[model samples]
Target: MADGGAPTEGRGSVAAAERGATAIADRVVAKIAARAAREALDGVPEGGAPPRATVTVHHDVARVRVSLELDYPSDIGGQCGAVRHRVAERVEALAGMDVPEVAVQVERLHSVHSRRAAQGRIR
Candidate 1:
């Protein structure tokens, strides 16, 4: 008998199967994805929102979706690819979950010229 009359063969002798598992929360994984996206980008566009992420984890697999704003006149495809790679890598490394899919959604684009024009700074 161990503490509180719990039956135990010996101290620190619990079976691995019975020891249970560590579960990482979905929100935590999402945060990791978002941060990783930010790391991949050269810079967040001025007046643009930062990266945001949401994820669904099931049986050690995580499917992530990231929404972000970018600057105009950039290699949008390359940027999106970098974000996808980084998010998957970080999520798997930090959460120990397999990331099979990372869906990148471009919520908006911020252009300096547009901003300047709209603000009457551009002649």
Candidate 2:
């Protein structure tokens, strides 16, 4: 060992292949995907739950599924697209894994009209 405790070169140092690899857990990747989706959406809608994600990683490839609720009267397709793009980009950048697919599921839509109706504010 060197003064700094690091392995000294040519002093019985093992090859890179001998060292094991670092693996990022599936839950960590899922959290990353969820956060990325939130970032893409700017935040969760009022009376709506934040995005939740599930990820499967295999051989450095990640497949993700994100479920979220959004405000009604908005661009649903565009929002989903943004989430997919951001998730894929972030997971690849942070986890160093290939994101082959991101499936976005819109769990619910919060609408002002529905709330008003439920509150007896509308005819």
Which candidate tops TM-score?
1
Give the clashing pairs for model 1.
none
Candidate 2 residue-wise lDDT, 41-118, digit = tens = 957887789999999999999999999998888899999999999999999999999998999999999996787788
Best by lDDT: 2
**Backbone Cα, N, C clashes tallied per candidate:** 0, 0
Off by over 4 Å in 1: 1-12, 119-123
Displacement of residue 122 (Cα, Å) in model 1 is: 9.4
lDDT of 1: 0.93
State the lDDT of candidate 1 residue by residue for 54-104, as single tens digits.
999999999999999999878999999999999999998989999999999
Question: What's the distance in Å from true for residue 38, model 1?
Answer: 0.4
Of candidate 1, the 10-residue stretch with the lowest lDDT total is 1-10
